[model samples]
Target: MERRNCVVTFLRVLLLVLMASVETTALYGVKLKKKEHRNAYATMMYMGTPRDYEFYVATRVLIKSLVKLQVDADLVVIASLDVPLRWVRALEEEDGAKVVRVENINNPYKGQRYFNKRFKLTLNKLYAWSLVDYERVVMLDADNLFLQKTDELFQCGQFCAVFINPCIFHTGLFVLQPSREVFKDMIHSLETGRENPDGADQGFMGVYFPDLLDQPMFHPPVNGSNLDGQYRLPMGYQMDASYYYLRLRWRVPCGPNSVITFPGALWLKPWYWWSWPVLPLGIQWHETRRQTLGYAAEMPIVIIQSIIFLGIIVMTHVARPGISKLCYRSSDKTTSLIHTALKFIAIWSILAAYLVPFAIIPRTIHPLLGWALYFLGSVALLSIAINSFLLPAIQVFVPLIGVFGSLLVMAYPWYPNGVVRALVVFGYAFCYAPIAWSSVVKVLARLHVSLEREQFLKLVESSAPSGFNKLF
Candidate 1:
């Protein structure tokens, strides 16, 4: 009996030891989960602007690229409360992002005269400081194109930024340790009417961190511990996209050539198809997006639009001879009012052919598809004008040819430098300006000649059915 009791006790003790070991393993796993999420790459999003969708697409691409590169950090977005639920869910479920929704920060500088609409809501970017749950946050703008994993940036000091300009640090990408104290202090500064020149986040942050330019460059510690205090980052971190236009390649000689920011014209962003060929670096960003986030959302609409535009072109060409034969009728009467009306309609039709694509092309479609559709849509609209008004094809397509020629001139790769490239573009436009102007003049003169011809074409008061306008 004594031996049996001793064996039973040994078994009970072994069972307890196994249970304790299991519990310890589970607790360690929980700790690992917390450690994995302590650092984040964050950006901000707010609604109520025309470029919201465009920026949202950019933001999605940026986060997904980081995820694709396997950065050892959580992806987060500081979206405003009004942002759509679908967008938030997409970010969470589709892209693996943690979104912190907050109220839009009031911009005290909004009432000031000459404030740019582009910077109106940028003050909301200051919310990065409020993310106290993160040990470090790399705040970013959507226009930033990461060339590689910048995970080393998380090892920098409490506040670190790159000086894209000689003296001014760019807010396009910055590293900060999230703290409630600093966030509240920023709010206090804004409420107290801080000296914000230009009334933009760049200007406000510039004034806020006036001494960052004097700080030493950031160096990640060999021991792999985070540092404290402000530090200046090398231009390599935020190499301005314009710098590439001058030398045709990245020549920034400091830090890691890890990121590029488009700080030039707002309309010439990397995502727009028209910005490509003019801005060569845009293709690189699109390539990154293509690999990580396929163009499924915008591709269907792009395909449908292309098909419709092509069909219109074919139908217009087939009916051209018939349209002229059926619609033309000799008449002896002409009036100043009638001639002027016809001339006006002819000019408007050509202008619409050139301008309508900007309205219909999907804003976030792949750049290649966008450019193709722009061309097809223009041609389709021009064909309609040609078939309807009997205008010369050369005169109708002059603007299209001129614009394409100018783009080619600007995009020519053999320019000695950007200045010479600029002059070449200017010269092309200066010479071609007259041709464009004369195209309109020639079209009006043709209208006058049509009225005096041996067989004058009948006015728009034709017997054709009203179904003619249903092509759209």
Candidate 2:
């Protein structure tokens, strides 16, 4: 009983922490002030080819956001040896950035060159510590956006970063003091293979600053008294955009933060116009580029995404039934195919029109279209499951409860304002909950049957004696 209670307590704590992390609100309220140190906001980029122009654009937008907010800091670009001289000149002269050329480090993990280039491009970022010109530097990834002024981060100590996991900090945005000694120590760690346990600079830095959380925080003299936990930077300093998908209720996209970092692959980047079709924040990124950088080329992306989106819709209508029938084995293939196709279209029509719009376009831009599509799509999606008889009635009822529950709140006769309108718009996502579950159940049922058959044949083969098996 004691052990069970301890386990429950641990689970509760873990659950609470995860829930807090998902909330797009500020966790800590520690006051911050800019220090007298030479503060710099730095980012790294390597232009291996013309395709690498995306990084250049990302760096420009980052600088523009910083400048727009009037953040008291110098912008530094840690460019690679491969970066074009013209780009370097542009960053320095045109963008008012200080460009520092650094060498690219080879991927420590074999066959991870793609992952390293896209995700863990932080090996060269270590060179920021060698920039003794800046007394203190806040290194941000080129993919980050400034929500507000963050010059006060300079007041923090040598090591300051947000928690990525339970014990490790994300290397996307971090504060550091530049010194040859610290740089050499990191180099030594790299040379000795003692730098990264997880084979990335993220883990490497965590190992380098093992006692970061336990360290005594820097307290400003103006505070008049020693205040505890002044060094701990709030999680709001670097908000992850992925949290948007977790809690559909807390709909403030930017949330309360000084910066929002989109930490993902090339396709997942917000600056990429092709990414606009998928990522909701891509619109804001594109707007920033258009207004600040005078970059407004989006026709190519619109054409491509339209083609892909329409292609998927066409495929869903014409080919989905045929594909779904392949999941099961039947002697009468024609009858099975016909039945599958009929049932699929029936259920798909129940929800496709409703949900597909939400999947395709962001709710902020077209709420009316999204709502219309939501109801239509729900009808299409339901027909596929209902005709197939894969989902239980409870699955349908739960989502209805969600829809009506929100509707009851929204239908309050006295109030009808922006908040209410926003609620009505966003709350429509819950209406498709039953369809999502039904789709999951349908897929799992087919998979279970396939798995069971395979297991049964294996059991039959094993149950027979060795001699009998050999005779057969």
- The candidate that wins on lDDT is 1
Please, what is the whole-model Cα lDDT of each candidate in the order they appear? 0.74, 0.58
lDDT for model 2 comes to: 0.58
| Candidate 2 lowest-lDDT run of ten | 24-33
lDDT of 1 at 58: 92
Error of 1 at 65 (Å): 1.5
What lDDT score goes with residue 361 in model 1?
89
lDDT of 1: 0.74
Estimated TM-score for each candidate:
0.80, 0.54
Q: What lDDT is reached at residue 173 by model 1?
A: 80
Candidate 2 per-residue C-alpha lDDT over 360-389 given as tens digits, one digit per residue, 9 for 90 to 100: 533222222333334444544553443233
lDDT of 1 at 332: 32
Residue 453's lDDT within candidate 2 is: 38
